[model samples]
Target: MTKKRALGFGYLPQESKHHFLLVTPRSPNEDVAVYERFDWDESENQETGIVEDNLRVTLDRHKWNSIKDFLTTSFNNRLKENDVTVGRFKIGHVPIERLLGKEMVLLMWAIEDSDPQLISTAIKNWSGLSREERWWLFTMANAITGHADDKRGWRKAIRFALTENPIDDEDKSQVNMFEMFYKNVK
Candidate 1:
């Protein structure tokens, strides 16, 4: 296995309990980000890493091109705020902030099973949502259908809201659907 580069958002490299976005490069422009959920367990030792097969979102060149600028810019800004050297790269095990991990996973979950052609649409809708909105949506989804193997419930609902529902005249169709789902999640 190639040594993966670690991108930190809110935690240091030593933090093992937080989630990770393992970006494995396939080619110059192609890579797959495996979102691994690492929950702390009392019985298990932390030295041995535990990577739950949570979500695999393949970001091809096109998809990467669509969101690269936004992601790099946003992440770099966060890194600077964390008092880390800006634009530094490292190898092996990417560590993302807990909330950032949730946001990224939520976006990945939304488009995991979507049509490849409609990625731009999904990304557009995702970008339209504020960080708080994204975090809230992730919180709701993670609370119920957050496990690596659980792929229904809020997960399915998120896919439907972002991918199936396109931009509308009001622009709140997707957002509205998210609110509606939140209300009906019981």
Candidate 2:
């Protein structure tokens, strides 16, 4: 008869005559027992929590490169599309979260593309706009590049852009004239 140990959830595999098996108990009440002439301790048993943590860390480190590549390819494809262009400016000012829907995408791409350095240079050149402007620009670039989807958010942003500078009397007259001309054309 093979010697068996209580595994909490079930019985541990029985020990054989020639070899000893090390088994971990599943619950607090279950006690681990050696099947043959071998020493075992509860501390040596792998804790589920520790194993999960190690797995998460390993996945995060190893998978980051693959994720970056996928995002870069996808973003490049979107940026290359013709319909989304707005006079050489593909991306417009919009919230990052609204466009990308995931902050991690932006963070990963920014890190991989050395966007921080580029951003720093842009900030230096456009010193008038604050950090918010730089961050917004980064987000807008990602959104425009198709790394993120921000159509709804873009509409709202457009409204804000148009309203930012009040229409001057001269511009208003030009707009009215254009409207009348378009109406006549119609």
Who wins the lDDT comparison? 1
Clashes of 1: 1
The alpha-carbon root-mean-square deviation between model 1 and the true structure, to one decimal in Å, is: 7.6
Instruction: State the lDDT at 140 in candidate 1.
Output: 90
> Relative to the true structure, how large is the alpha-carbon lDDT of every model?
0.62, 0.30
Give one digit per residue, the lDDT tens place, for model 1 in 90-181: 33345566666666777777777777776666766776778798889888987888765567999888887677666753554345667668
Superposed on all Cα atoms, model 2 deviates from the true structure by an RMSD in Å of 25.1
Best by TM-score: 1
TM-score of 1: 0.63
